[model samples]
Target: MWGPSFSLRDRDRMLEGEWHTIRLASSKKEKVEEEGSMRVFMEHMKALEDKSIGFKFHTIANEECVDHYVVADETETGEYSVEYDGHNKFTLFDADPGAYAIFDLTNFKDGKSFNLVALYAREPDVSQEIKNKFEELREKHGIPKENMVDLTQAVGLIPERVLVPTLQIPVATLEKEETPDPPVLSGDFSPGLQHHPFLSTHHPATSSHI
Candidate 1:
């Protein structure tokens, strides 16, 4: 992502609906993890009066859904920001409209930080051309080819974009558990990501959420 590669050529056709985490890589990842089912729903919102878009990341692990969000504004073009981590930078650099999106997240928490680039696709997989583009962007970020990992490898899953009901259970009412819920951004932030962000989403200050 460079010089603001976010496209507004066709807003709805490109950015709306559900997407899957195809490939994810980081400047620190040296190995790949075993595959499993990972579900994350990126709810695209029009809550702001301006042409800004809100992205809320949530998951259903053991039937627990939390609330957290970040807004990205665009009159004709735009970028993004993370609300959780005070020392983090979120950027949406290049996107192929509805086809795919490439974003880089630099998460800094507890004075530790790592750069990550993710490829989100409308479907479960990406084309070879798109993969090349992803690698190109990561390489530009000083991330080598060895750092990349196919999160969707050998994992066959494709879910349609369906309307999910909002979290009606208040935070206070929801029961707390030992394991951290996905993407709340309230946990520890450590180096060397252990979980695929698609499985356990993270923002900042959290041990593992992307």
Candidate 2:
């Protein structure tokens, strides 16, 4: 819901129609209670082996989907849940204790703010050992334990430009032609004559001798 992924200054690619499995952790009493209560319910869902994940793409131009998801609550029965707002947030329940697999759906309206919403994957019967390992990896990577959202799917939209062989021009052809320098100004020229300035009167040739 909030993290480095949301703060990225770049546009991320949209990945929809992709499924994943994840591990999630929570320390809140209510969340812990829910985890215990919902454990059995989660296992009932179809088993999803593919851990590959992805993000749902969105923009200001298309906001209807986010609006609907925010207001609407679909019963996923531990499979998934959607949180509503200016953007949509979804959570899946697939992970060992203290961990949950996350599926993020982002609506890039601000290109700032919390533009991304995350949902968790649903998987029951996660062992404590697995959960510990998940936490270990997260800590090793300096990942935040709170408000965590994984962006395994939000890759760069534009591919890197490729370097291809090109036709070469001869060195002589590539050389630029020399440009002539401008003529320098000198005091030999009369400023008034060059500018054709207005003259009030031409005094009669003053004869110094006369």
Index of the highest-lDDT prediction: 1
Give per-residue CA lDDT, model 1, range 1-89, as digits (tens): 22355544336334766667778777756322222112233444333445455565544332344434666544322444444434446
Deviation in Å, model 2, residue 139 alpha carbon: 5.1
- Candidate 2 regions exceeding 4 Å error are 1-10, 32-68, 71-210
lDDT minimum window of 10 residues, candidate 1: 155-164
Give the residue spans of candidate 1 off by over 4 A. 1-4, 7-14, 30-48, 58-78, 84-87, 154-210
Q: For model 2, what is the alpha-carbon lDDT of residue 42?
A: 16
lDDT of 2 at 150: 30
Tens digits of per-residue lDDT, candidate 2, 1-210, equal 223323111211121223233333323212212212111111112212232222232211111111011122333232222332223333331222233433333222234323222223333324466455455544544545763323233211211221111223467755775657989997767656336433222222111100
lDDT of each: 0.55, 0.29
Query: How well does candidate 1 score on lDDT at residue 26?
Result: 75
How many steric clashes between backbone atoms does each model show? Answer: 7, 22
